[model samples]
Target: MAVEVVSGIVLGSREYGERGMVVQLYTRELGRVGVMSYAGRGNDGAKLSPFLRVLSTVRVALRLGRHAEGMPKLVDVEEWERGAQRGWSCEKMVVGCFIGELIQRLLEERVPNEDFYLFLLERLGLFAAETQDEVVFLMVFLLDLAKSLGYAPQGEYTVSNRYFDVAHGAFCGRGEGEGADVIAGADAAVWGRLLDGHYLADLHDVDGSQRCRVLYQELRYLEVHSGLRLSLRSLEVLKELVG
Candidate 1:
């Protein structure tokens, strides 16, 4: 098999056997891939562990699956960037874990999306930088991820039509069906600002409580649209932090 080289960020991993493990990575060239690595066995094992940590970016050489649908084997890995291993706060780590889990759940294996890949890279870098509000960043990331996945809310907010209909993915007038997905005008405006691509720095003036509300609404939107019960363990930690 021909060796393929790709740059990727580790999403998550699980121990497969006593010595081997399955690592999930979102690659620049191949999107999300699951490869088997022996991380408990040789000298390379020690080196691979750190590089495979969640959100760690690396360049790797892979031995492609022989049957095309089989699992690929990890040949080697090189760290692309390094940051403080233990410097991340509890909030940051939880948010990072949530993002990783969300990506792993939403994307299909071996399906490549270059734009989404780049977006993930940038967001991960921002998280690593640790200069922004983690909760606010997470809310923005969820909105952006929804846009990438094609379920982002549509239509511009106007004075007359300000309510965001999460079920319909659009702005509508008040008294719009009274579903649990309909966000209030204030919250709808916040979602609009985020969907319009406002940076976290620009939104820094927004109160943390409002940000948390917007995030909850966005997560509900995702749940309604994607039909997946998202894992909220990390989100619980974030809620406590923000409050």
Candidate 2:
């Protein structure tokens, strides 16, 4: 059997049957991979399933097949950096879930993007370590995630050309069209600040409501540009937590 060890983040985990566990993990080596992650069958399956929680950062050894016949099998887990550990508060878990869902939705399987994986791992580790009472962490994470995904917004935001076109992914003098593509006036200005290389660590003073609005707009921008209609269920919960 071909075997390899990799650092991975668990995007999602679910039970299959009486004693089956499956996980979707994004790794630096292989990108998004679905694996039947059972260290043992029957009652002994409890040994490893407890550690493979969603949003956990883990080092896993996978048993690979000679031919690409089916999904790989997780044979051993060396380390588990769980996001929802014993001391983790509800807010931390919520942020982890929201970001996990967004990444899982935005990323496609088998697309090997090393930069994206590293970006996610670094920010995931950071977010896991700190729990804040604001939405800045989420927004900061979005900025990196957007850049990693190759759509960190384009053009500059100015008074004469202030409208943000989500579909075009650039600011314009006036929006090219109506619908989700157009964001104008104060809202557009807020987006420009939030996304226009003006990260929180730089210069930003957005309040709770403005932050939440920018979050919504960021999601919309991603949806329009990613070629997928994103419906992040955790978004509303994240918004409520921040708003």
Candidate 3:
């Protein structure tokens, strides 16, 4: 018996070989899957790259009465979003790859998150558009993703406070005649804006160093809350350009 399914293409093969190649894909239905194929070669090989959306109909063979391994086999492959690839429409292609790698690492394998898959698919579409502000775009993506992954920051804040508690993932409240132990003032303002899905672009009145500090603070919050470290290559690129 065999089963067939349509899955969203996440990432896959990027190697040259005799037969074909080994690729990894994050499918909406099957989660993370590995495929070995001889079909994608030359022109086909180029199309089989990471995030080259494709439709795969696979056949699963079960070994009975014998000690053997079982994995689904690809019976047919079809291009899904064939025209989605343009040059580098958004940030550099490398930055996009970095984002994809982060997603691939953070997401668990074989877990059902149809909503997340769809959200990611839409994000890819938006990233491809390249019309929006990339800095704001990344911050929005981070905040939304953080909330989804159970890292919604504690909103407790006050005008008199001064530091954000990274480990607690919250804005520390002002105490009696004193600021909170962690976050306060400008950091509180930034955190409040992030929680509200507001873009940081509006805060240009603040010094760039202050902005970078807030970004670093958020990064620490994400690390403590999600146990994932983003490569932040895009941030580095921005820093180099500014310097």
Q: How far does residue 134 in candidate 2 sit from its true spot (Å)? A: 4.7
Instruction: Pick out the ten consecutive residues of candidate 3 with the lowest summed lDDT.
Output: 58-67
The lDDT for every candidate, in the order shown, is 0.57, 0.53, 0.47
Q: How close is candidate 1 to the true structure, as a TM-score?
A: 0.62
Worst 10 residues of 1 by lDDT: 1-10
Which regions in candidate 3 have their CA more than 4 angstroms from the true location?
Answer: 1-95, 108-112, 156-162, 175-181, 198-201, 231-243
Candidate 1 per-residue lDDT over residues 1-243, each given as its tens digit: 211122234343454222222223334453433432333333222234333434442332223222355533333222332344345554554455456556655553224355665666676666667556677778778888788767877887888788888888888888874777788767777877787764454676668788878878887888788754554443554555565
TM-score of each: 0.62, 0.59, 0.54
Best of the candidates, lDDT: 1
Candidate 1 lDDT for residue 23: 27
| Better candidate by TM-score, 2 or 3 | 2
- Across 70-141, the per-residue lDDT of candidate 3 in tens digits comes to 423323223332233434332333234345545645653223255655666666556555534555555566
lDDT score, candidate 1: 0.57
What's the count of clashing pairs in each model shown? 0, 0, 8
Model 2 quality (TM-score): 0.59
RMSD of each: 13.4, 13.5, 15.2
lDDT of 2 by residue, 38-70 (tens): 322333222334334333533322232222544
